[model samples]
Target: MNKVVVKKIEDKEIVWFKNSNSYLVLEPIAAAILLKINKNNSLEEIKTWAFKKITAPKKVVKKFIEDIFLLYTVNNTLKKEVQNNSGTYKIPTKYYSEKYYSIHNCIFKIQFQTGFHLLKIHPIFAHLETESQNKFHFNYTIFDDKDFIVFFKNDAFIGKWNKNETHLFEGKLSMHLIIDIYKKPETDWMGVFHASAISNKKESLLFLGDSGNGKSTSLALLNANGFDCIADDFVPIDNKKNMYTYPAAMSIKKKSLKTLLPVYPELKNAVEYHFKKMNKTVRYLPPKNINYHLKLKCKALVFIKYNIEVELEINSISKIDAFQQLIPDSWISPLEKNVSVFLEWFLELPCYQLTYSNNLKMIETVTKIFNNDL
Candidate 1:
């Protein structure tokens, strides 16, 4: 059932919030269309309501519902909801299945069902198969010699890719392969960068770095110590220019876990390589004062490099240069119109670089920076 409790966010529009915090604002008619489909109303009742109140043609209402369903599928948040609605068949229904594969911190989930191949996904990935599906010059099929193939609609692939021993399903897709996908010509055009972000209040800190420069490990250290995580690997900035933080319930691998063990004592007995290809296993500790809806205004850009010393050095960097490096890592293409809006949001933020060795020194350095300057 559609969650159709529309509230007036501002005088001009009504907003609908989903359980996952994803929302859509609608005009009066769209709101009415949505309201008619709320859990309280049956499908027949909804059609009756639409026929009476909607001045738009029946086709328009049908299109709206179809588009809504597609959006729900692409977002993947509908899976559990759809599962619950199985007996009703209240709307057209589809099934989804995913399989997990191994290859380091990378995780990929391939989703497929009996009917049309609608690929539901978590937002962390850049779709290589979709490259051939661009609107300007769409190709329904993508092939890699005789070994692999993928199919699509528009720029979003709606089919599967298969290779020996490699299966894609509904979990985290291999992040290693996902990362590699970002380097291909597809990603070269789509653009992928390396950055880590943390948010508090309305401010976010994007940590930019090259591979193996310790971005993920530093994020783990910060998470273990005190900082709340916005993203471990990537932050998806929507085309609307709004930035959202996707949180993962996993630990990062580091050369030293002792640096974190003292802060998160439960980690002392936590399992190793517990599931998937995740190398280090650390128990999740609830953030002390954080909630999922906490939205931070991006405040800083920190370029980090790991050192083995006992000291920390923090310095300012040029915002112009920082933007150049930071925008690419954004999970969504910043070149999109809305992305420019996000770029503006990011540029207004402060930028810095932290060079540190040892966990204590790194914590001390960040603490001082937060207390004194940030």
Candidate 2:
């Protein structure tokens, strides 16, 4: 999230700015010219390069350089108003179900307007539920706004999700809790990845890929066998590069049901829910062996996949390729401090792709990674 990654398509190059999480697409010549630009290079030098390179006039390259080049690596200032409402949904007349959870030392009181709203949330924190309490650090009210579900954090509008977007709503809610539990504003977080993370007490490895990569299934299997799951789907890091434990349950997809049943037999009786947008039928497996207080240094980033008949293969991958796939699925803080930390942190870690069909080899491979034997 902190690199100016350049990936070449057939002819166009995608230039992505880690600072702003924005990108520009240009022809190879322009990309090469602009990428070669140095802050200290005088305007004349750029004009000379442009003349020899793209052969464009130096006449108006000044405006192009000042406007476009300057914007190529824009640094977005922190917004004073971070949560801009797309639309408003008023509080409901009544809430029927309520619960409280204590995550890392932070307590949250959530009152759901209906059981359906409760179902979207309560399953994940059923393990962390505490006794009824009128006082808490954060008050969240979930409304069953028709066609949309609205959320309020301490009476301030958080956001709304369409009825079909309960999954997105759950993810966003967890993010707000992460900010609260750490006692920091959203800007203070380094980044949050749509990845699964597992730790072995000393260090952590992040599993990232497109959907159907078996990232979360690997986490469930490893957690059932040996490793500890620190977070799933929505993994966050701080300015210190510590990946904290996220307490939500891991969703077990229908495709992996047979593979995981032998390990977690209770899944046979677990309720299955379908998400049409994602085309996934999943069962929520309550996270096991979570430290709750644990935060580990990230050891590596592994892009993983599982095939029915393929042998195990794991190898290093280009960071540029990895970042391109990662940025679209992640939320990296735009604040300069987090940006700086993310860049420095990413540069130091080794990136790998692990493809496997044999679960035994997969487990052994991840263990060796944690032990630095790989």
TM-score of each: 0.47, 0.81
Model 1, span 181-224: residue lDDT tens: 22222222222234666654455666778766777667767766
RMSD of each: 18.4, 5.0
Model 2 weakest 10-residue run by lDDT: 73-82
Model 2 misplacement above 4 A:
1-20, 23-45, 52-90, 114-116, 144-148, 161-169
User: What's the lDDT of the predicted structure labeled candidate 2?
Assistant: 0.80
